[model samples]
Target: MEQPYTLEPYQRCGLASLGLAALRAEYPGLSWHTLGGHFRSSQPFWAAIGANVPGGYEQRGVCSHVTSS
Candidate 1:
């Protein structure tokens, strides 16, 4: 999944969180994975959503693992 964007006026209103919640509800067993360096600045966000950045190299980047809740 790509980083979610909201208009400047709508930033930090939990819109992205809400959307992710809905997606989880729809796909209960879904898992999210991405390259570690793809969104280097969003590490906190990924962690907040329960994603784990495991140690080790994945291809050319690190591995990001998001297990289903």
Candidate 2:
């Protein structure tokens, strides 16, 4: 899933669609169901590592532990 989209620059709408299609074609064995499961499980981790932007803040607002929450 991180094969192409991560940190990419802007693109026109048509080319963006084509790029997504190409990415899909390249990963024939990819499973959306498994991907969704992992994504769901990792949401908090992603929030913890959120983008560093102008304000120098990106992490989750609250500390979250998998077992605690």
Candidate 3:
């Protein structure tokens, strides 16, 4: 789930939560994983949804991989 931004009038009114909820309902039992730097900003949301971050690697700021499920 990337940043759930909306137009000025629609910001911060639970739209993101509703979208995520719909996705979860559509894809039951599927594992959602996000890579490296995204982990930094999204950690809280992932934790709230019970996601687990197993490990990650960064190679000279060129290549990176982070597994969260």
Mind giving the per-residue lDDT tens digits that candidate 1 earns over 1-69?
654557989866767667777877898767554423546655555555544323321324333454444
Model 3: worst 10 consecutive residues (lDDT sum): 51-60
Error (Å) of candidate 2 at residue 32 is 6.9
Pairs clashing within candidate 2: none
Q: Clashing residue pairs in candidate 1, if any?
A: none
TM-score result, candidate 1: 0.51
RMSD of each: 8.5, 13.1, 8.1
Taking all chains together, each candidate's TM-score versus the true structure is: 0.51, 0.26, 0.43
The candidate 1 region of ten consecutive residues with least summed lDDT is 52-61
lDDT of 2 by residue, 4-54 (tens): 333335532345345544755788544232122334644543334323212
Return whichever of 1 and 3 wins on lDDT: 1
Best lDDT goes to which candidate? 1
Instruction: Name model 2 segments beyond 4 Å from true.
Output: 1-13, 31-69
**Top model number, TM-score:** 1
lDDT of 3 by residue, 1-69 (tens): 554446879855656566766766798665454333444655555444333323221222423454344
